[model samples]
Target: MGVDAARGLSVIGMTMVHVGPNSAEGLGGAIYGFPHGRASVLFVLVAGIGAALLSRTDERRWDARLRLFWIAALFLLIGLGLQSLDHGVAVILQHYTAFYLLALLLIPASPSLLFGLGIATALVGPIAYFVLRRLLSDVVERETVGWGDGLGDVLAGLVLTGPYPVLVWGAIVIWGMWIGRQKLTYASVQWILIASGIVVAISAEAISWLALGQYGRPDDSTDWRNLLIADGHSQMPLWLISSIGSATALVGIGLAIGRRWPSAIWPLAALGQVALTYYIAHLVALHFLEDRLRFSDVRHAAPSAMMLAVLGIGFAIAWRRYLRRGPVEWIMARPFDRHRRREASQNPRP
Candidate 1:
């Protein structure tokens, strides 16, 4: 329930980042900026935690691995298909598949090892990306949104240069896997995570501010000095660290809140449970409304986002009353489980 609530918040935050009012003045700026990079980080981290939970539940290793493979394949196909729509937003499902594949290799690893690898990725991925970007400047010139262009371009994009490069973003997922393995229901653990996350987030931001202030931001976007700043979507080490910390803290807070007052967060938890459906639905809505919304205008931003949330949350709650899983989730689950589906159908949810 805590995880679902946290994931719900992540979805909502991401929606705000996409449609909220963008003003550099007053509370609107802070509201618009708060979830910029952090929402995606939380989203990815939650995915890892979910994978870990799945692995823990299944008794047969082969069965779990097969399910993960199916999921990855589905994501890859769907992501590629979505890219063809030219929806404007950089779809992350392809990169998400990369993380799912990576998880297969690390699922059997010890929690400590997982944590170590996550930390190493946090430290090294950005630097490696920087070096690779410099070296392969000509080959990977564009953002490389989809594989329709070429295999090399898409591979480079998914691994290093895309909006959510698996190399750097994988750390959050790995750490999330570690978090899932922990005894998260424990109050002590929750508090520790909250405190440590706040400390780490603050320290990372402070260091980034000091470094950037002292050296000054360079005109060149590719300058190494740019890496020192912790701006959202910059994909720098500091940003990664800060995002991880903030995400951890948010998850911890969600866990605490859910434990304390489960009923209070029912809507959020319901929304989280069907997050994939909401994500896809929102994207489709955005695509249709793209011209009319005029995303650049502040007037439609907040209203659009509010409408999305209301519709999404309402749909999730209504759907959950009749079905155990989301529509997409149900399709993903039963496509490979004919026997399970038969038994479930016979028994019925109620």
Candidate 2:
């Protein structure tokens, strides 16, 4: 339930970042900056936890991991297809697919191992990328996100140049899996998450303040790479800490909500169950706006985003009320279901 709630929150955050205004003057500015890279971080973090949970269940059967690989491939394909829509948004799902594949390799690791690796990656990934970018012969810097770009360029976008680089972003997922192994339903665990999040977020900002003030580091200059790392440049150590801590805090809040307002959480829970459905639906809505309504300006896109998101959740609740799973989820799982059934028949449990 907490997982679902966190997922729902990420979806909403991502939508706002995509469709809301872009300025630093008023409410729009606040809303625009809220999700920046954090929403995608949370989304993938939840995915890591989900993968861990799935692996646990798969302990009873052998084919689950194989199915996971197929699912990852499908997501990669779907994400690339969404990019073909050319919605002017840097979608995370493309990189998300690659992270899933990378995460799968570590899914069976113990919780301690997951946490250790996550921390190591968060600390070292940026430096490694910094060096590798130079060593990769500036290949990543020249690349741009587009359907026409070469496959090599696209791979670089997923790995190094994109806003959500898999190397750093995937560490959040690993940490999330570690958290998922914890006693999430406990109030003590929730408090730790909340406290850690607030502390780390504040610390990151304080560091940035010092960098820009006492040290006289210009925020615009890329020379001091860590200056604006908190919420903008996600490849930095502080940015990963701030964002993953935010995600941890969100999951904790979800747990609290599940305990306190069981009824109120149902709608978002429903939306979370069908997160992929709504994810794809939003891009389709954007495509429709492009093709039919001819809405060219993002300044006024908030209403459309709100309408589509509301409609998507509303339909999800209505559909889930009668059906077991969302349409796309059902479609994705059917093949695995059939295989499981056939395997069960072939080796009858005596």
> For every model shown, what is its TM-score relative to the native structure?
0.92, 0.88
Q: Per-residue lDDT of 1-350 in model 1, one digit per residue for the tens?
A: 88898899898878877665434455766776688889889999888888887787547556667778888888877777777664576777777888888887777878899889989999998788777767776653437466575777667777777888888888888999998888889998888888989999999999999998999985665688968988887778999999999999988988888889989888999999999889887777777777654365445676777788889999999999999889888878886578667868899987
Could you tally the backbone clashes for each prediction? Answer: 0, 0
Number of the top-ranking candidate, with lDDT as the measure: 1
lDDT of 1: 0.82
Badly placed stretches (over 4 Å) of model 2 are 57-61, 133-138, 142-151, 217-222, 290-302, 343-350
Angstrom error at residue 134, model 1: 2.3
Write out the backbone clash pairs for model 1: none
